[model samples]
Target: MPGALAAVSDPALRAAFREWILRVADDELVIGHRHSEWTGFGPDLESDVAMSSIAQEEIGHARAFYEQIAADEGSDVDRLAFDRAPAEYRHAALLERPNGGWEFSILRLLLYEQFEAARLGLLAASGQEPVASLARTLVREERYHSLFARTWLERLARADAEGRARVQAALDSAWPDALGLFEATPADGVLRAAGILGEAPEAQRPAWEEAVRPVLQGCGLSIPAGPAREGGRRGLHGPEFEEMLAQMTEVWRSDPEARW
Candidate 1:
């Protein structure tokens, strides 16, 4: 692997960098789309507007990362984002699952934001050029996202037994998928070996769990016990992802040559 990203000349290393970038970008894109679904349906007017802003911010983050990859690969950002087949996306399954309900989305956001922060922290000082810088800035945004999720989580937990049970159910269902966020691929080894990823995804897992456990337990939620579900990193996904990809790509696929 090259010390300088601009001087990356090895095919395998370049491929690994692309894979790492796509993993982060795809997560943002898919989760952004999921969040956008709540645009006009949030539990309140303020929440509706706030979530809409966060959704757009997530999409913007995705575009930034995609643009970085596009610059290197001589590919356009939209093509990289919308032109890919469903099997080509590298996002975790946690993000691709449908937003089951307000409780579900809030729980998923709480879990994912913690993971995202841990991920960015690993990259913060990795000396990985543009991505390190990107991570530094993105982590700030994630703090707000985490805060929003936590506030709602606490509210629901304290509301009543029914509210607490609903949140607990959502957390149970989402825990396995959230664990999948750290499922490593072969490319992860390449990045770790090259010092591009300061730590392995597996190493990040305990920290992620530790960060979320206190808050979740305080809310009367228990972490699900089991092996993490996998396959999303390798592009395997379920019907929900297929439906999402269809809707996401519809406008672009309608006329590939048309300008947006």
Candidate 2:
């Protein structure tokens, strides 16, 4: 683990790198939790199982990342995941928002999966040590996630006007939060200057936009014009997060000192 994460001598750069990693891990954790909620409530049996599998994989990714960070910082992974104050979380606001409906969840997944793929691709290309290897491995799973999202998106949109309208509405509502996925932060420039991060989050926005535009337009969905809903990156999250955290940490908090 020590060899995998090559030492960054500069304290600030190391701190920035940790922040970036936490953001990625938190995103995966929150979204995975949300996805897991659909385990038994999906539209059909096959979809229920598939979505559950995807949810589990996402949680696994989060665990892997948290483990890496924990090893580097001399902290425990479980504590890093559930012990942080809600405001300290670095995930995007889009991930914290409640799963409103099937269309909303599917569209959100489609948007997030694209951004994640591009983000991981950059990480994999950066030639960073353990993280690069991890990113490469995770990107493979992300591909299937992308495929799942796109497949459902296409079918729902093409099914009927009602289906298309629902998808469009979901797209419109989720657009601002989706844009927030690329909200720039101080750590971004620090990581970029250090060559630890391949591109600034904002710089990657154009590619992400281009990647999703055609698919969205084809689905008869229009990206809404609005300022990005910011704050999640800064640790500010929606009210739903309070409930989510409570439920997510309940078991752990119940026995913080108890052994399994």
Candidate 3:
């Protein structure tokens, strides 16, 4: 994204940079939190450990990226994290939507982790260095994250009718909104012009769809063809997001200025 950030001196470009960063932040933060809900609740021991690691990696990633941006603002990362109002969060509605069960969470991970892998690949190739370097490193971790999800997917795919039913339904439920992950903003053109994005951010959606469709199909699942849900990028969220935001910020928002 070095090329994409080359023009960040421009106010519009800078704002775009911040917005895209926030969106990425929101994605990691919420999904990490959602996955964390399974800390001790996974169906078995190995899965419990694996899911916990994934959750930690996500929150850790969010913190690292937030630190990079926070330094420029003369503030710390946590404020931008737990201190924000739910309305201020920019994660996709899909992520904030409650995890119905273990299989549901795994399905969500299977879909989003693949999308994240591609996004990180794009960032790694972006002309930016420090952030690009961060993205490259995170992608390596994400490869393992994705492999874990795929392992579960293959096992769950071959499970009994009821297990397959639950997993398949979760996939269908998460598919369309997964597209929300790529909702474009004015920042998109800036990122593109700055050479941070390989192309217009919107251009990646169809390719992402094509890239992952086979995985779902091979599982005997079909993409949930529905109207695209939007607004998470702009901090617009749904009822589920509202509940999640309140619970997430409960601790930090109580005394935001206090040093932890």
Q: What lDDT does each candidate get?
A: 0.87, 0.89, 0.79
Ranking under lDDT, best-scoring first?
2, 1, 3
- Model 2, position 54: C-alpha lDDT score: 94
Using TM-score, rank the candidates from best to worst: 2, 1, 3
**Clash count per candidate:** 0, 0, 11
Query: How far is 246's C-alpha from truth in model 1 (Å)?
Result: 0.4
Please give the distance, in angstroms, between residue 196's alpha carbon in candidate 3 and its true position after superposition: 2.3
Which candidate, 1 or 3, would have the higher lDDT against the true structure? 1
- State the displacement of the C-alpha of residue 236, model 3, in Å, after optimal TM-score superposition: 1.0
| Inter-residue clash pairs, candidate 2 | none
Candidate 3 or 1, higher TM-score = 1
Which is the leading candidate under TM-score?
Answer: 2
TM-score of 3: 0.92
Per residue, candidate 3 scores C-alpha lDDT tens digits across 1-260 of 23233435777777777777677777998999998888888899888888989999999988877776676676678988877777878888788889887778877887788778888887778766676788888888888887888788878877888877888888877876888888777778877887777867578787877867887788777667787677778778888877877888888888888887
Q: Candidate 1 at residue 106, lDDT?
A: 89
Highest lDDT model number: 2
TM-score of each: 0.96, 0.96, 0.92
